[model samples]
Target chain A: MKKVMLLIILIMMAIVFTACGGENESSSASENEVSIWVHTSDETPEGEAMQSTIDRFNEENEGTYSAKIEFIPRSGAGGGYEDKINAALTTDTLPDVITLDGPNTAAYAEAGMIAPIGDYITNKDDLLPSIIQQGTYDDQLYAVGYSESGVGIFYNKQMLEDAGIDLSTLPTVDQPWDWNQFMELSETLVNTYDTAAIDMAFDDKSEWLMYAFSPFLWSQGGNLVSEDGSTAEGHFNDENSVKAFSFIQEMVKEGYTTITPVEKGFHTGEYPMKFGGSWTIAEMEDYPDVEYGVMPYPTSPDTNELVSPSGSWQYAMASSSEKQEAAGALIDFMTSTESLTEVTLANSVLPAAHSVVEEVQDKVSPQMNVLIQQNQKSAHARPVLPNYPQVSRVFQQAVSDAAYYEENSDVQELLDDKTGQMEKALK
Target chain B: MNTNKRETLAAYSFLAPALILLGTFLVIPALMAIYYAFTDYYLLTPDQRQFVGLQNFIEIFKDPIFIQSLKNIVLFVAFVIPIQVGAALGLALLINKPRKGNIFFKVAYFSPVVLSLVVISVLWLYLLNPSEGLINSLLANIGIEAQPFLSSPKQAMLTIVFVSAWQGAGYQMLIFLAGLQNIPSTVYEAGKIDGVNKWQNFFYITLPLLKPTSVLIMITTLISAFKLIIQPMVMTQGGPMNSTMTPVYYIYQSGFSDRMIGYSSAMTVIFGIIIGIVTLLQSRLTKEDDI
Candidate 1:
């Protein structure tokens, strides 16, 4: 009986050991296979464009390399695709090329999960400056964005006209209205409508807070971090940042916006305006009653400098993969002018490269044209920091806290406290 | 070759598969987590990890968000256990007597339990929306103002508590129902012979007899409450101001979102210790009652 028990234990141990040891030993044993992972399902237009791009790459490279694509769509809470990537990181089973969000460029590069691909990119200058900015970390380009994104103030044309405001007198992307002008317009709309003036999506207590609202800080000559992305103390807590924060607080205090806005409030014309991105254009099609037009971001009163947020999923090479040249060629092909045009048009997203910008200019809608112009002129990528996730969370909290700002809610103090938290994340 | 040896061999053979699975999946990962708790094991840079001793532990204590998460979870468990267990008891008692449509009532009560938590949470999110939700519209019909149930930090945890109880109590009610059924009718007949009234019979007989079932339900509810994540994740993303953040949710965020696996592991260890102490106290008290 004792011998039998010992034998059973040994067999179990052998099974466990063999199971653990069964991981593939050679990543590049099949040298021609170039695996690519994207963060959208194949059913989506963006995924279809990605598949076509890979098909083109494979056809062009033919026998030397065979590019394959896998779509892993992200969940609503932003997990599925990233969860797979994180798991793959530990198992050494990461694909040759992977799609990452733009802000993660610094973190992935710093952790050595992705390799620098500056030497691999063929048309570096043709890419939009914001795309380059979003993909660079510590002076090295680690990734290349395949598309760009833009946020603008989307308004109900009927509501503004009913409020006796002339549409043409409104600020254009070339010369946008300042914060004061925006607020005045909001107050008029609110009084006329007897409801909240705009939906800032304060209810979306996620990365949207940081992504959509950070440009407000930038427009005020304030930044979440310093130029080199080293620190957040003076920059995040500066007077300019406080001014931008107070502007948001005032909007909340005056009932121009609500922390808990009705779902699709702007879509249903419950609000006169919304601080929405280019994606809202497609969603607006569902509501034909609300005639809407895109407007540039309301600039800070001090600088009157226009700055809008820009970022999207970008392609990066996985460090674990030995097929660096093949992966690089695929990435270059995916971000090429023709590929970019196809993707931007198919997905109805902004063009990442200047050449594609011209290719897509006349093809997209007039509202999209406004966003494209904004992207070309004033789009700013978020700070490229290795601790961007933590920092962004703190920034999001600051915006949330300020939105509930009362008389006791000193904007400076709130920013100062948040800056401390940002400092901790930076360390 | 005796009977004793043969029986022992049979028992060992039956237990082998389960033991191997437990060791491979649960025990190994738990051991790995404890080991990583002492290191700076960033998820993306696993190979570059370095031993950092109690640094991660110390940092977690210093983190205000971590402290707030701990407080939120404790509060959630404190409220959810009693409310959920009590609701289950009430429901069990209501359905204990056999009557018309008993099966229909049972299924209706158990329906939420069978549905996915994510679906329930999303449904509740829309229903509790401040302005456009059905709940607020109902409130408005009575001339009451719309409430920011999930968006307000002051009310978010309590709102989650009620929601959790609504979704979870049904399963516990089924357990209580079985426990109720196990109580023989003769005991109630004896109570009736002693001239006890309806409320009196319930208090003197049903209450004391249901002790074991109630204890089991309370313990399970307590533990599940401490593991709160999905509701907050789906509904609020752990904030209008991190009011609904729980320790488990924060641990997940640190490990996956921030890639600070070591810090998350440290939090897990600490959370496990806290749970261990609570369960130990509970068992000790329950044992005393048994004695």
Candidate 2:
């Protein structure tokens, strides 16, 4: 009996070893196939478009080089995709092709987790300058994006009419409203409508704060980090940045804006105007009764430079992938002009390639046209540095503090505190 | 082989699988966490790490946010434990005997315990919104001013504590109920023969008999309360002004979001030691009481 039991144990161990070895053999056999990881599942429109593009690539390539896609859920308790990606980075389980938020390109590249794909991009020159800027780290292109995103002020046409402001006379993108004029318009709208003049989405205490509000700092001739990307002391807490934040505080204190607004305030017609992104145009389609118009982000009164927030998700290559050629082929196909136009239109965002934008300019809605114009003229990408995530967090906290400012609150003091935090993180 | 030796061999064979699983999952990870605490390891580049000794620990001491998180969790534990335990004991006493509505009451009280913490937090967030919320709408109907329950820095932590206590009290109540049922009814009968009132019997008999149960509840609740993260994270995002930032939330942010694995591991080691010491002291004290 003991001999029989020992023989059975040996057989079981052999079976287990065979099963494990089978997995490795199958994976090596399919080495020509590339895998892509995306944030959204295939149920969404953008995800469907991406899958379609991948399917096309697979059909055309056949056995030469096929591609597969995996979707990670974008929302959860522990930071969702960001947390998963970080965990995957440590485990070296990253896919050959990965999509990351625009600002993460620099951090991923700096950590040597992703490889530079500049040479693999076929239409690098045709891509939007802002897209190129967002994907570049240390003068090398580490990622490529199919769609670009831009933000501007979306206003209610009826509210403007009630406030006796002529829509036709409103400043164009070439000559946008300055800070003083913007404030005057806001006051007029609030007084006439007896509601919030603008919804700045202060309740969204996430990356939205940095993405939507950084334009004001840039328009005022300040930045989150120095040009050399070494420090944030002078640039982040400078006089211009302080003034920009003070304007936000003053707007809240003067009742020109609501700090904690109901979500989708503009769509619900609770606010006359809101600082919104290109995605807002798609969302507004659900509220057909609410007629709206789009305008550029306001310029700083002191500088008169037009600045709008711009950046979007980009495709990257993992450094550990042995299938670089197949991965590059998949990326090239997905970011081609036709694919970009299809994905952008399906996703209801701006296209990253200039040629795609021009092709779809007439086909898109008027609001999309305004977004395209802004992207073409004045979109400025956020700071692309390895420490951008930490810097953005400190700036978000400062903005949140300033939004809750009291009578004796000082914007300069808040900025200085944030500057200290950012400097420490940089170290 | 002899019968005693064969029995010992059988016992060792029976325990092997469980021991292997525990060592792999729990013991190995804990040892790794301690080792990682002495290094400067970022999550994004785990292969590249440098020894930093006690630098992370020293830095955490000077880090204002970490200090604030410590204060926040201590305050949470101080507020949550008593309220949760007292509420649980009260419910257990009410339903100790066979009452007409006992089943309904038990189910109603324990419903929130079954719900996920994220769901409860989200439900409470909508209910506690400053404007256009069920709670505020009710307040408006009664001519009371709207309260910024989660938005206000002064009220956010207290609101989280109340919600957490409400959701957790039911589990403790069930434990207390089981303990209460185990007590001899003859003791209560003896108290009644002595002309002892209900309150007197509760204080002298029930309370004294429930000492072990209370110690168990206290230690478990204290340990769980120190790990407060979900409520504040879902509701407030540790905001308004970092008023609701707890140590566990800070650790998660540092380890996962910020990728500062070494700093986060150092915090975990320190927090683990504190929890271990507290648990040890409580067990010792309770054993002495039993003796």
Candidate 3:
């Protein structure tokens, strides 16, 4: 009995010792340490390059400020990171500096989770104007874009040439093809070559399909949610979007975009033109035999304006950070052109800062610059609302189901059910 | 008298740790589950609960999805337990006959019991993947069209059951092996001398002696089958319109994903009661043969 009591006491002592020991060790470095939350490209060569730079910074500025990097793995489209940030906020253990962007930066900044970065943006000329627009949310720079991505048309040049489609006379960046012309080219390529569907993945979570397709929904006179962003608009059932949805479906039905069984689909090269982002360039680099070209997403047949969904992951400061100064320093260092260029090179996207783009222009592939330009011209982001996740989830499930069961499924019914559920979830 | 009193106190003190452990770990949690079954608790946002009355129960009943899962659970238990236990018993009986490499056969039959559930699930997932799997390739050779093993609603639940039975049959085989060892050789020798053939001798001799072992195997197998969560989770994720969704999976989904701790507690309580009732019925049905 005495032994058991003594053992319990020893265990308690050990826990206390460990916790206190942690405090004691950190106290020495806390003055010099910058605890920054790093998201994206932490595993690639370019990510390695950024880490090496930080290592150099820490070694050189050892007495001034030590770099304490905290990496969160959120590689694919940066969808699940918001829930984690929310969880961190509730626990009061947020990092000194965290990364977020697009709807994410907007949502959290509104919630007062991220600190303002206006004081940190003295080097404004060092950043891109469009990227600067994304970083500055609600009149204050809450986050700096780590990398920029724009959804656009990525066509297999070999597939087009084999289909006997003349490519030298193909529409250039300045002379962009309209939706009707794009459709004609796509249908001809598929039919003439007898190839598979358009290269695209149907993800209901990120709804990045919105990037490739939803811009047209807007251009053809539709909105995802109501103007105030208080309600979902049931756009698939709306007259304009219904026609747009049918146009996309006709691509499938008319043999231009066959229903490629999930396996024999785009990523496998069974398809020709992929409506995707800059990352598509990185993915296609492995297929050296397959030559591809990049352009803006097709303009709407009616609107005559090229549209793409613009979003980027950014770095932010957590409200609960104890080492605020160090964290801010890390964020500042990471957002600098040197680090931004490394991130862009790794991710196959545009540099987050203008200076970085100018510095690393030769380093990045030519295919990727088209995406950067596309993002600069036109890309809209999802509405940054607290209830946006729930709204998106409900909308995506309905739309995907609508696409699958085009006839039997009622888009209005699904919209009504999910909207009600969204309202309940918000409450 | 004082010394006697001190000894008595010491005896009670010795029992204190065990009593505290059982009460804290088992009894208290059970009671808390029952309490929370009547409330609506979002685990992520604690300090907020509403007295829901019988609302959770009503929701469970009204939810077609929940009802279907319950029915599926029962069907799985009914079908899997018999086949698995019977196969184990037959295998045990075969190995009981003294032959060359009898121990090797016994060990070979029981090898799968040593494998972890996750390892087994992964192995089966690759083997069961319809497009590029061993099972489908073999089926194609027989001039059969590739069957949607995990993807189709028609085949998913059954595929999970089949995989589970294959993995779990070995554990029950050990129990049956022990039971076979307990049977007397004298009765079998007498049966051989009497003109009773192998089938009659086995049914008449082996069946009665193995009653207790059968009962034990059945009860344990049913409990395990009823708590089916891993196979469906790793393989199907309870999809194709949620045909493979189990009660325990529902409980996890409610507790962690939905953060509806109160609803999950209600489910846990109900599942506990169901298990208790099943155990009671099993004992009652089998207790008569014991005497």
Report lDDT per candidate: 0.90, 0.88, 0.70
TM-score of every prediction relative to native: 0.94, 0.92, 0.74
Best TM-score among the predictions, by candidate number? 1
RMSD to the hidden true structure, all candidates: 4.7, 3.3, 6.2
Give the CAPRI class of candidate 3. incorrect
Model 3, residue A412: what's the lDDT?
Answer: 55
**Which is the leading candidate under DockQ?**
1
How does model 3 score on DockQ? 0.12
Q: Which is the winner by TM-score between candidate 1 and candidate 2?
A: 1
Off by over 4 Å in 1: A1-33, A63-65, B2-10
Candidate 3 per-residue C-alpha lDDT over A1-427 given as tens digits, one digit per residue, 9 for 90 to 100: 9999999999999999999999998787566676666664568665576677678769777788887665666634553554565566657766677766565665566566777776765566766665666666656777777777677777778777888878776765556777678778877876775764365554222355444566667667676666655555454356665655656655655655532233434455667777667666767766777778876767667776766667677777765566666667777777777777776776566666667767767776767777776665665655555444445544444444444444414545544554565554444
Model 1 interface Cα RMSD in Å: 1.3
Model 1, B95-139: lDDT tens digits are: 988899988998998999999999999999999998789999999
Model 3: lDDT equals: 0.70
Q: What residue pairs clash in candidate 3, if any at all?
A: A34-A326, A98-A316, A99-A315, A100-A314, A128-A354
Candidate 2 backbone collisions, by pair: none
Task: Summarize candidate 2's per-residue lDDT along A1-427 as a digit string, tens digits.
Answer: 9999999999999999999999899888788999999988799899999999988998999979999999886884225777778878777798999999888888899999999998888999899888889999999999997788888889999979977999998877999988889999998988887777999888888788888889999999989888878999998999999989998888888889876787777998888999887778878889999999999988899999998889888999999999998998889899999889889888888889889978899989888898898887888888888877788889888888888778228888888888999999888
Candidate 3 per-residue lDDT over residues B1-291, each given as its tens digit: 999999999998999999999999999998988998999865534445789899888777765556777877987888788778878888887888889998888788888788888788879877876656788899999999978787666787888888888888888988998898898889889888998997898788888888888888888888889999988877765654557879998787666545567888988888888989998998898897684
